[model samples]
Target: MSHDLFLAAKAAMKNAHAPYSKFPVGAAIRTTDGRIFSGCNVEIASYPEGWCAETTALGHYVTGGGGEIAEIAVIAERMAKVTPCGGCRQRLAEFAPAEAKVYLCDDAGVVGTVTMGELLPYGFKGGILKK
Candidate 1:
């Protein structure tokens, strides 16, 4: 089932709109309810206005009424491994637990799997700010 998520991410990468960077990325997230959401990076002409694939997938999951991501997969080309960026890591933390599995993949397949906490230790939690 995890491998299936990676495959879905790879499929999504085909539709990435990265004309400028030429570095396409795809992301897939599996909710605790067993539903999977996939997304591709969409780059814009304006700088710093682009969205990461992980953010896109999270949006789809939230829009679909999903809660608590169990696992996530990120795939990209020409890299040893692909992981979510810092901003995306925080975005993912909003809907995923610290122990959620994060799969890093390349064109071949999954290269590694790390927990969300490993990706972003001491991540900013909304409750912390509320105090």
Candidate 2:
């Protein structure tokens, strides 16, 4: 909430590959160590083959040697207070704690905020996958 994730997400949104849907979105995730990873939506020719911005950011976060996620920020070119999709919510919940802040931003700045748990109250528990 106090970091530059809004700016980071806005910058990433400019690089989105969204020719098909023309809906460019961006996401930025912050690790507890203050590292920020940002990503943009990438759409392909196939309708459902494309991934969301949060997915790309998660990829970066994972490959960057993952840690506890502190917060997340998301923005869209045409929409304000844009939140992550369902799949992304689950993916984020895997790394981010229930208390982690999720910022919904517009072009200007963060307009709203929600915790990971609040956003996905009925989310599938990750512990079930542990063996």
Q: Each model's C-alpha lDDT?
A: 0.90, 0.93
Q: Estimate, for each residue in 43-62, the C-alpha lDDT of model 2 and write its tens digit.
A: 99987689999999999999
TM-score of model 2 (CA atoms): 0.96
Per-model TM values vs. the true structure = 0.95, 0.96
Question: lDDT by residue for model 1 over 21-93, one digit each (tens)?
Answer: 9888999999888899999999999946899999889889989998878999999865658889999999999
Give lDDT: candidate 2, residue 14.
99
How many backbone clashes can be found in candidate 1? 0
Q: Which candidate achieves the best lDDT against the true structure?
A: 2
**Predicted candidate 2: what Cα RMSD to the true structure?**
1.1
